[model samples]
Target: MKTNKIIVGLFYLPMFGLLSCNPQEETTPQYKTIQQAIFASGHMEQEDEYIISATADGTIREFSIREGDYISKGQLLVRIDSDVSNTQLQEARVVYNDAKQNSSANAPQLEQIKSQIDQSKTQLNLDKINYQRYADLRKKNSVSQLEYEKAELQYKASQSSLQVLEKSYKQAQDALQLNADRSLQQVKTQQAILNDYSIQADKDGIVLEVLKKKGELVRKGEVIAKIGSGKNILKLFIAEDDIAKLSIGQEAIVQMNNYPDTTFTASITKILPAFDEAAQSFTVEAAFVNPPQLLLSGTQLQANIKQQGTKKVLVIPSAAVIRGKYVELKNGEEKEIKIGQKSGNWVEVKQGLTEKDIILLPKGKSKEEGVAKPGGE
Candidate 1:
């Protein structure tokens, strides 16, 4: 009986030890201020970054600018082989010169027309003199009636011929002028097309990348290079769910992958109005308040944008809330609670609990697991 009693005591001792070592922790709700923020991830980009594309189809004859080169507006960056365009331009030039000469005051066609007019005028004067002589002879009965009528008809015919020649000269002049104007327009159009073969920088910037080789074939509208303003800006991609919380002038806490030990501050400057379908997120642009000494383009980063102002409210460890709806009480009962904003492991308790209420931590969790203390972040 003594040995049995000793065994029973050991068993009870083990049970007592197990009961004393409770796994769940207990804490009372405390009043504190919590700030809300939206999480975003993206990369560093040069401000005003844009792709330079080919305007005419041809093999690249010359690519003058290389990566990391500084360029000015109107600087020629590339020249296409343009053998065909050069030929077309030559043809256009030939037509333009011909048209210009033809439209000049001393054009051969006009000169020939003027010479004909001079000859006609001379013949008209001779015919008028003959007709007058015939009329005077007829009045003196020195010429037959047939002879006078013949001279008068010859004078009238000369007058009609002169009028017709003048009209013909005017029509020919107008047609030549019109043809010259049309040809000149065609020349200008061809010249513009030829200019497209020479690609020039549209803005002052740096060449970030060269996409085409010197001998590569380039199609119209194909990208040839990437360019941007040398200044850097942070481009963040925010999820659709959190995009609505973002606004201009908000503060951002940034951590760049290149600078692991440093944290930077930035202010939101722009929010793209449309959603990015490829990325499945919305883009937000921010500028650093005090940028780093050196910045590399396309640097990956993560950030948190402040969504709203701080608020004073009842708070508790997030682990205490069961499935975001209720919490375990100290007396082994579940009490429903309304939660507002959450920051890390801390949550704001809006209703169904008071500062005096004691809450039990969930299973397999403890205060040491990054749970904020009262009045702490």
Candidate 2:
């Protein structure tokens, strides 16, 4: 038994030494299959907001609303101090009245002038008879030729005076007629000017902002206030590349910054015809069908629009897929992948990896010289 033990010890001692010298090999950096959440982050915005501006130039006499005030359609937003204008209007009215009273302005005033002419004619007839009697006396030599000439001249002077009076009366009547016509036009012009005293809202909405202070001067046709159509909509901006995937009536999930947990239901409402030149994105308008109770104008929001067409897809963290199809594999292998339908967070994986294989997701690129590998971290 002692000899057998000795032989067993000798056999095991070398094996132990060999095993002690050889440590377990460190695990090599390897690519891993990790589920990564693809994310597209943006904020929420209110779709329906109206901005108001000033219309007519004058000091604001009264302002009916402030920021965040609810107002109705045709509500008087602001009033300008139109005291001077009103006074002018009143003066215009007086002038108009005076013009109306001017009898010469009316054709009937011509009758008054005609009556004066008839009276003058009667005086001329009497003077002519007197002149004729004087002329007969001069023929009997009781009156001299010089006296006859003087009487004839006096009668002719009366006739000329009547004609001149009639002409003057006709001119006065014509002037009165012109004055009446002018008065009527003046009244309308004054009314139109007076109407500018008050500024009214064009639509039903809350006041988002008050641009002008009370008593601020403004010009005609200048925009004073803005109103948003009460559509209760949300404006969402989808990237130009992703806009093609969005269509009208497409479902979307809306979230506001103020309310984090709640998700308001919404759908694509309109796609803008023109793209913003500065922002390389399409303007997509969405309607919140069942809007949240806390919703208000100018509320910021975040949107996630899901693209249609569901095919089996391999999705990785968007950070894992960089510069098109290239992604880091679980084996620390950076390889190109075939990509398909892409939406907000998930994209369809057409090629390069299978369901059986796991893809590595990189948190992000490091500023270090070494390439980002699956097991390098």
Candidate 3:
């Protein structure tokens, strides 16, 4: 009986130790400010960074600006070798000038046509005088009817020849004028093509990069340099599942890897509608309200876009809420609870649970295990 009592005491001692080590975690909901946000990772970029490309294929004769140089709009940035284009332009000008000279009112061909017209007019007047004489002579019986008829036929032939000369002159003038107009258009087109060889800045910006050095060959449409507007902005890529929570004008908190201890505030300026297949995410852009004193382009950053602002609401540790729609009560029973916005490690209770009710953490679960959901389920 003594040994049996001792064995019974040991068993009870182990049981008591087990009961003492495990305890139910419970907490009452309290009202506090909660912020709901969506997280994204991205990098810093200039507000307007454009890649400048060559408009014409040529060797880089000279580069006026270097990297990190500030330039104004319409400033000449590069000079491409324009020997070929210049030669072509000169040839076009010669052709245009020749065409103009040929089409001029004083051209040799027009002068010859005018001379022929004057001669034809003089001959027609002489024939008309002879025809009038023959008519008078025939009426007076001084000349035969056949002689009068011959004079009349000669006069008509002179008139027809004069008309043909006048028409030919007009046709020659029109043909020369048409040729001159076509040559003028060709000259203008060549001039435009020549102008493209000298690259100029399209906007006021700083030269961020120069892809080709002097004397390097650049093809038409090839990127030659990069320019920045000198204003820093954040570019983010949010996952497809979380893109719905973002909107223009929403505020965001930005943190850079370089500035680990500091966080900057910004506002959503743009949300791109297209998805990037390479990134498997949607693009977003933000502008800083008060930017940091030292910021560089291409700096990587992480951002939290504020979807819901801070508000005083009943909240509990996220671990207390289970399966998103239910919560464990202090009385060891699971009850359905309506949830609202969530941020960080806390969740806002919208219905089914009140501040007066006590919430129990799941068995063997700690507060740290409750991860905040981006968008509350």
Candidate 4:
């Protein structure tokens, strides 16, 4: 009987050794209400950012405005040295004045033509009177036909001379008027070119950067400064694979790198349809619900956009999930699971597991004994 009892105890001793060797933490899944979300990182950008560029090639003579300066619409930001343009403008003004004077009715050339017209009118009236008198005399046969014929010839010659003079006056006037108009247009063109030397702000904004300093030469279309509308907006880049899951009006929680302790709420305001090759992602824009008191441009941030629906699902410790696909049971069996939603340290188990099923956490993973209660962080 003693030998039979010793063999039984030896058989049970190995079973005890196996139980003691298992050191994994054990926990069970619990029902938790959670919302699905996608994560993305980006930075804050000022709305309506514009690059101020030089319209013409010249050296920047005056650049009083610096970065962070507030500017209003049409405010002069920089003045370029335009000596050549100024000289051309002066010459244009002189030519315009000369043409304007010549086109005027009181010009010397017009005055001379007016005097000739007056003299021609006087001669025409005298010739007409003499011709009419001679015709009356010829009707009464008091004058010879040769005398009346000479008077009529003189009157026709005077009329022809006056007509020629009047035509000459009109032609001269028109030519001068045309010249004046052409000169005036040239003056306006020069004036516009001179205006290009002065760069002005197109809208109210803050100067974000001053790319060109005083005395720096800038070519046409070269960037001189950068301005922003001062209104803050989130410019997020989402992964191409995750972009399709996002939509306008989705809620996003933002944590700025500068304000690490605080989190802000925002809503998706815009989403670009095309993928950005440079960023390797799709662009998304958001508006803050209640923005911070002071916001700076280009502030780095991270955000999580919550999906539309929320439901109660069975969830286990994220540490217990193996390779994001499987979890180990307390009985030393590996169980594969289909996950649905994920929050900080918790993962939702959609299938292959129940609330009654207990899981073993892997080595170095945080292990909570028993079942974890559903609660918000």
TM-score leader: 4
Comparing 3 with 4 on lDDT, the higher-scoring candidate is 4
For model 4, the stretches where C-alpha displacement exceeds 4 angstroms are 1-35, 239-244, 272-281, 308-377
Cα misplacement distance, residue 237 of candidate 1 (Å): 2.5
Clashes of each: 0, 34, 0, 0
Q: Which candidate gets the maximum lDDT versus the true structure?
A: 4
Q: Output the better candidate (1/2) by TM-score.
A: 1
Prediction 1 global C-alpha lDDT: 0.82
Whole-model Cα lDDT of every candidate shown, in order: 0.82, 0.63, 0.82, 0.84
Q: Of the pair 3 and 4, which is ahead by TM-score?
A: 4
TM-scores across all candidates? 0.67, 0.54, 0.68, 0.70
* Candidate 2 ranges with C-alpha deviation above 4 Å: 1-51, 103-112, 117-175, 215-224, 278-280, 309-377
lDDT string for model 3 (70-175, tens) is 9999999998999998998899999999999999989999999999999999999999999999999999999999999999999999999999999999999999
Q: What is candidate 2's local distance difference test score? A: 0.63
What shift in Å separates residue 141 of candidate 4 from its native position after superposition?
2.5
Model 2 agreement with the true structure over 151-174: per-residue lDDT tens digits: 899899999989898789867876
Candidate with better lDDT, 1 vs 2: 1
Q: Lowest-lDDT window of 10 residues in candidate 1?
A: 368-377
